[model samples]
Target chain A: MNSVAFVIIAIFTLAAALAAATLPNLMHAALCLVLALLGLASFFFLLGAEFVGLVLVFIYVGAVAVLIVFTILLTGRDSREHRGFNWSGVVIALAVFGCLTWAILKAQSLTIVPPHIRALTVRQIGQVLMAGYVWPLQCVGVLLTAALIGALVLVLEEKR
Target chain B: MTPTLQAFLIVSAGLFSIGLLAALSRRHAIFILIGIEMMLAAANLNFIAFWHFAPPPHPSTGVMIAIFSIAISAAEAAVGLAMVIAVYRHYRTTNVDQFNQLKG
Candidate 1:
């Protein structure tokens, strides 16, 4: 039963992702993208990453999707381009997939460092994130702050 | 293959490939945004798989990264769409053809 559920979720997620990628209608694609994100969150839950799952729903579906919609609404431009899937692109994509699969398989043969498993919890993460990865985390914060400032400038700029 | 971790892995691979193709071949910026979202989900799936199949002794290993990525990607989408809007305002279109102002 659980396997069935996972399969169903996987199918829906992949279908929605494909729709988001290939659908020419921007609004429809965005809606599909939201669905895809929701499906991924559910997958996370099934896999026991409850916090991660909730974050996916809250951040991707709630914040990111909403922002995309808001931007689309603000533009007031009709998405008129009707793009049927290109057979050429399909062939090319398959080739790319084949090559990537081969590469991943080849790499998989190599022995690599296994992930250390001392503990796994939000509390442990909070400790490691602040103690060991503090500088890098701060760097990420600074990068986001810069991005926010850049966005502010761009949005406030004069339009021609 | 039997339906288990392997099946999920294959589906994740397919999803990631679809995302890559969309990002590479699509002309619209919004399509590319969707592609990025798909790719992020693929990574999240990988995290979940490791958590379920070969997780660390602790309870939070791969899951924390997945959660962080989701939050970071949200900020990414926000700034990304804002820039898209600015670009549209500048050139009156979101078509990728006209977006090559820095071509050297």
Candidate 2:
């Protein structure tokens, strides 16, 4: 049952990601990206990373996808040039895929026998985030604040 | 067969490759940003999968890092799209080919 769910989620994720990448319409691609992000969240959940999964949905699908859509609409240019297929990109992507697949296959023999899975509670994660990881967490806070202000400054219309 | 770590890696790799292609091929700046987001997501997926499978004694490390990446990517998207909006306002086009202003 778990494997079945995993397979289903993986298929959805990969297909949506492919669509998000290949679709010419920026709007459609953004929609596909939402689907892909949702599928990835489910994949994380299946892997038992519950917090990360929820964050993926909330952050990626909720915020990032919305931002992309707004940008597409604001820019008023959603269509790609009608230059047919971009063969160079296809070739490069295929080559990269081939190399990565070969690497994965070769590296399979060097796997460390995984220790029994350890279940981590959100409480532990929170504790560590506040205690051991406080500095980086603060840095992220500052980064987000700066990003918010910068975005506002960039998009604000200038007074004549 | 059950999904293994290798399976996850393969999926992540595929996602990353697709993202690379999109980033390289797409003319729209927003689409390029989307592709970059995909690549970031792929890397996060790899991190979470490894953490889950062979986590160190401190299991939260992986999740924390993934959380950080998610935060950073969110910031990235916000700022990136804002730049896109500004660029569109000035240039009236989002096509990468048209932004060859610095090309000597």
Candidate 3:
């Protein structure tokens, strides 16, 4: 059933995220991150946001993951980092988690009720994006282009 | 609970804390960058899930924000990697702890 699939996806997503967080070797962590991203994309699909899911997978798994692995290959291999959790970090991390848990519950209780909202289809999103939210969308594109140029310039300087 | 949105938020929280730990625990510049990226991903996940559950009346800001976040994240990765390359070139290493020449 759909509900079963949702549960399965949630389990995979959480497991992959935990792996991404805790995986020791840089290479292994990156790999786990790829898995986590893929799981997230699938979750998007299950939510009926197929386009968003594809974009997540495309950008995170296809592009970001490739770029990271590329950097790994370009950098020397012998450089190793010590892997393990510190007591202080764990304590701080737990504190932060507790705060976030409280916030989510508090917010959920106060949210405006809309139990029967319709899922926004891809077509509906396109219409809204182009007509109502065009400015932000275009601004994002411009920023991405600028970033690409900056990356190229920096890389060139590095190579020189 | 029955795997509500709250559960997803908790997962995001755990991942985010892990990310913050990695960012703080390392003096290496590249690892710091990775940790930052992980945190960004966590935030993006929250945005997407919130959008899914809390749709606006007309134009969904959540989807638009998610799209923008993806673009911003891509930009960040590009810039961050470039900075890493530059730092590595100048010092022949990327460890933040090793850089002491500029302390004057």
Candidate 4:
């Protein structure tokens, strides 16, 4: 059952990712990206990280995907099909994948099965965030506020 | 047999490579941003997988880092998209290759 689910999710994710990477239409690519993100969220669930999975769906699919689509729409004038594939980039990607796969396969310790463990709950996550990770949490809050303001400033119309 | 750590790592690697391809090959700035987001997601998956496969007594470190990573990626996406819009407004084009003003 576990292997079957993993296979299905992996196929779904990789296919959507390929589409997003290679699609000529910007809008279609953006939508495919959402699908791919959904797949990743499911993977997070499969790994027993329910809270992280929910956050992935909320932040990535809900917010980031919408932002990407909106950006595409806002910059729709040059929405024509992209130019031909950059073959050199394809070569580089393939080369990188080959090296990574080789390295992962060579590492024998990675063959072990996942040990059964209790699932992490949202309450515990909150506890950790407010305790051990308090400083980072505060820092992220400040960073998000800065990013929000900076993004707004960037897109704001020039007053000249 | 159930999927092992190697399997997850391989999948993550594949996702990362695909993302690199998108970022490197795509002409549009938005596609590049999508690629970057994909890469970040791949990294998050790695962290979670390792966390799950670790010994019986698990620390919340992996989950915590993943959460933080998600927040950071969200901010990154917003800022990146905003930059794309600003560049589009100034240059009237989203093709990354055409933004060569800084080229020596």
Best candidate per DockQ, number?
4
The Cα error of candidate 4 at residue B19, in Å, is 0.3
Q: Look at candidate 2 and give me any clashing residue pairs.
A: none
- Which model is ahead, 3 or 4, in terms of TM-score? 4
CAPRI-style grade of the A/B interface in model 1: acceptable
User: Which sections of candidate 1 miss by over 4 Å?
Assistant: A82-87, A99-128, B1-3, B55-59, B100-104
> What does the interface RMSD come to for each candidate?
4.2, 2.0, 3.0, 1.0
Candidate maximizing lDDT: 4
The DockQ-based CAPRI class assigned to model 4 is high
Q: Give the winner by TM-score.
A: 4
Tens-digit per-residue lDDT, A42-117, candidate 3: 7777655677788888888889888887775665442465544456766787789889988988884534432344
Rank the candidate models, highest lDDT first: 4, 2, 1, 3
Regions of model 4 farther than 4 Å from truth: B102-104
lDDT of 1 at A54: 75
> Candidates sorted by TM-score, descending order?
4, 2, 3, 1
* Each candidate's DockQ: 0.43, 0.67, 0.47, 0.85
TM-score of model 2 vs. true structure: 0.93
lDDT of candidate 3 at residue B90, scale 0 to 100: 70
Q: Worst lDDT window (10 residues) for model 2 chain A?
A: A77-86
